[model samples]
Target: MIYLPLLISITEVIIVTVPVLLTVAFVTVAERKTMASMQRRLGPNIVGYYGLMQAFADALKLLLKEYVSPTQANLVLFFLGPVITLIFSLLGFSVIPYGPGLAIWDFDLGILYMLAVSSLSTYGILLAGWSANSKYAFLGSLRSTAQLISYELILSSAILLVVLLSGSLSLTVNTEAQKAIWYIVPLLPIFIIFFIGSIAETNRAPFDLAEAAVIFVFFFLAEYASIVLICILTSILFLAGYLLNFTFIVSFIKETEPYLYAILVDSKHETILSDPIIEGMVYGLTLGLKTCIMIFVFIWARASFPRIRYDQLMSFCWTILLPLVIAFIILLPCVLFSFEIISSNIHLL
Candidate 1:
């Protein structure tokens, strides 16, 4: 009896983690293919069917590569850096609900937990660079630390708007709040801010000042894993997760609900439509589709834009994005109160 819960937890961890690791692997291939098409060049087509196996091959190669360490580096902290990054990046997924009751560790403060975990990932980068005992690596880490800190403010502010409207810090609650309407519909500017901040937060190109020391597979995995997780978070926060909540789709589904129920239900038993397994699977797919769309946008931005200089990056964050985000943060509440549109569930502290 004592081991039962432990076993279940371990199983849950596997279920949540394996797919993310797989997605992180293929995201690399997808980015390559996406960029190749954009540039009118062929990507890794020869690795497997349309290069689907390219990521696996690359993983194998990385695994087989010789490990090298800086002679003067603090070996403990050096190796610990990537491990810290990858663990914290993966930790954010535990609270992200894939569907109803599908999260590994759903809680009321899931959004806050994610933010905390993500913030910790920056420390790993800083440690990795500083521990490397190399001038260039240390400089790169410093740059990343500064960039992540700057953009995180804009991202957190944008999320606060969603939290205000939803009246909850739970990601699941945020998704449910959007069942009739997505936050993106009214908070488009905030969504834009959030999206750009996410790109910078993840060190994506055009704002990729933190992309260094990719020779370490752990670093590679951590980076891509963060990218995928961020995309999913974006979808859940702004796009309504699996529910979508589009008016036409909602009405269309409503019109077809009976037929879908009749077809999907087992006549001998109750409808599978309400079955947790079936509902979870369907919702999972819907959320996945949204996440994929967000991932494509990430890749698209990478392909479309060139990396900005560090000074320009800092200037844009402080001079442009910070001011705009601050204004939105200040004005959004007044607008909500003036319109009497704030959720009644929200309470002043």
Candidate 2:
């Protein structure tokens, strides 16, 4: 029995970890290709058929590179920074349900668990900045930290709307609640608010401070890892995951191309995905497809938008997202009551 449970856990870890790592890989390639397309150029066609192997090549390069720690730097925290970053960034995915019984950890406090894990990455960034013993690194980390804190508040406030509407903390259950009608229809404004907050939370373009390319790439992976997680979460929360109530993921992908490109361009979303096995696959595919669209938006924004001033960054988060989220949170109950959609009162704390 003990051996069986251990083996099952190992299997589950493989199930969740491998696919996510692979998704992050292709996300890098998509960023490049999308950026190239934006500039009216081709991207990564030489490296293995449209640069499919580019991400893998980049990974191998990073792995082979020597660790060059500064002599004056605090070695302990400096080294620990990446470890902490990679861990917490991947850790948040544990609670995100991918499909029917697809979650690694389907606990009642799943949303809270993700929130807590997500917040912990800040320390990793802080340590990376402070331990480097470089003035540039310190200033960059300060700006990153400020962006994290301000946007995280907006993220949480937006999540509070989900809690009120769904009346459950588990993402799996919340997804089920949206089977009839996706939350995006009723709460489109809040959805947009959360998404914009997600963009800032992941420190994509505009909010991102331009820094040295070498070290910034390391920090980029860490932040972008969380971006991968949040993108998936956003799909589940607003896009209705596998239920396919609204083929928004595939629909959004159609924007960048005639059909859904990148991840799930496997032609298009078929409406007849009714079989359980097929439903699960479609569900998982839809989630991945939606997340691909989200990631593309991340890269698209980076390519198109200019970096904003720090003061403007802080002001937008507080003045715009905060008040809007608050208004929505207050208005949500009235909407639910009027629509007669109120469910069990789950703890919003």
Candidate 3:
């Protein structure tokens, strides 16, 4: 039975990974097409079927390209960098509940697991920079390391708010809590902070200091891989990844049955329309769509904003975002406690 479950997990990983990888591939193509259209230029029309196969062509190109290693580079660490990044990036999906009880391995410490895995990905970047033995790569790596570490603080703080509000570290539970109102409304500031941190974490435009290329298209694939992971994580965290029903339902549920707001409470147990497969599909699709949109916004930002200086970037996070986030963390509990006190007084009256 254990072997069967393991086999099933392997199969599920293959099933989920193939589609996601394909989507990430084509997203690049679609992004280029969209950008080209905006600039009034013909995009990849020469490839198969309006350039739909262009992504595949690009993949082939990359595969065929020489894996050049600097003579002084630490070959083992340098190669391990991308492998570590790719593995950690994919590991996060295991806990991301696509639907109720539909994840690959739903655990009690799902959120914490994700945090640990995400933090592990930073070492890959650090290794890449240090291994390369190039001035630009080292600088890029330093910037990336500092940026990820600092922004991770803000990210974890924001996620901690959700964990506190929902009172669980499980992704499914978190999604269930949002069935009434997405956490975004009550935690809008955290949402914004998380989003900014995500962009920085992925090293997207305005924060792409790590792989910023003045002469060469340096580590472009690795950079995009990081961005893809950030997009996935963003969907998993803030957007309520497999949860359906809107903010109105969440609000209604909270107003009427406040006590039943646990993460996986299943308040609508009496509803007739319950299908696990269908539910899983819906949740997966919802998550996939949200991720796609987030990735689009990432590309849009890259197109729209010029990159900031490294000092300005670090200053913004430490001076502005970090302080604001700290303040919110300190204040949120007090506000909630005050509200509870006021409610209790009214009832006593």
Candidate 4:
């Protein structure tokens, strides 16, 4: 029985791990394809259909390449850095629900789980920077850590709005709270802050993504992974997770229309599923749509914007956004109180 349980656990892990590995690859292709369309050029046409296999090819070559460590660097930590980073990247996904029946673990503290796991990725970079003993790598790591830490507060503050409204730390609960209407409707400003904060966390703009090119593969992989994960995290926090409805200002999709193919939503536009297999697949796709769109915005921002002075990033986050979110937090209750959003709570406060 113990062996059987172990087998089942391994199977579950394989099921979750395969998709994440695949997603990391395809997001790169998607980023390239999107940027190419924006630039009016052919992105990747040779590998598979319109170059779908390009990511796979790139991954294979990267995997097969020789990994050379710096002679003066800490050998154990040098390799360990990337390992730690990749491990944390995969770890966070376990808490994210694909649908009602999916996810490896549906912990009640999912949001906290995500935040804690996400923050650890920085340690991996720091390890790599120190292990490599390169000045550029170390500086890049320091910038990465400082920038990510600074932005995480904004992320948390913005997310705290959702936590307050939802009354739960779990992403699943926060998502359910948005079933009737996404928090984005009432929390547009906070939503925007979350988006910008996410971008900053990934070290995309106002920060130097190119500066760490010397660290090359590991740092780069972690960077890309962080971007995509941030997108998914945003999809859960602001938009509804696999809800099949969005409150964004405008969209090509219909209000009731399913974002995924018919596999997920019935003809009548109902999203709840009676069939287990189809429910899981459809929910996965529905959630994928939101994550994909956000990832596109992330790639687009990278392509369109020029890097600003790093000091400006700190100034904007500290001087501008920090105060802004604090004021918003204070202002939210007052507006709610005046409008009768919180009657008993208002009096108690």
Candidate 2, residues 1-349: lDDT per residue as tens digits?
Answer: 7699999988998888888788788888888888888999998888788789999899888888887878899999987876787789888888878787888888888888888887888777788888989988888788878788888888888888887888988889888988888888988898899888888877677776523311645576776687799888998888886567546655776686663354444445444344577678877887888888877877877898898888898889888788888888788888887887777564324
TM-score of each: 0.93, 0.86, 0.83, 0.86
Better of 3 and 4 by TM-score: 4
lDDT of 3 by residue, 192-307 (tens): 89888888877778888766621122245545655666676666666777766735565676678766544423666432224566556667778878878888888887778889
Task: Give each prediction's root-mean-square deviation over alpha carbons.
Answer: 2.7, 5.9, 7.3, 4.6
**Candidate 3 segments whose C-alpha is farther than 4 A from its true place:** 1-3, 213-229, 246-275, 341-349
- Which ten-residue region of model 4 has the weakest summed lDDT? 246-255
Residue 232 lDDT (model 1): 93
Local lDDT at 26 for model 1: 92
How far does residue 156 in candidate 1 sit from its true spot (Å)? Answer: 0.5
Local distance difference test scores for all models: 0.88, 0.80, 0.75, 0.78
Estimate, for each residue in 1-349, the C-alpha lDDT of model 1 and write its tens digit. Answer: 9899999999999988998999998999999999999999999999889999999999889888888999999999999998999999999999988887778888999999989999999998899999999998998899889999989888888899898899899999999999877889999999998999999999899987777543467877888999999999999999998784434553565487966545655567454546777777878988999999999999999999999889999999999988998898889989988999887777554
Looking at model 1, residue 181 earns an lDDT score of: 79
Off by over 4 Å in 4: 205-214, 245-273, 337-349
Q: Clash pairs of candidate 4?
A: none
Q: What is the lDDT of residue 34 in candidate 4?
A: 88
Sorted on lDDT, highest at the top, how do the candidates line up? 1, 2, 4, 3
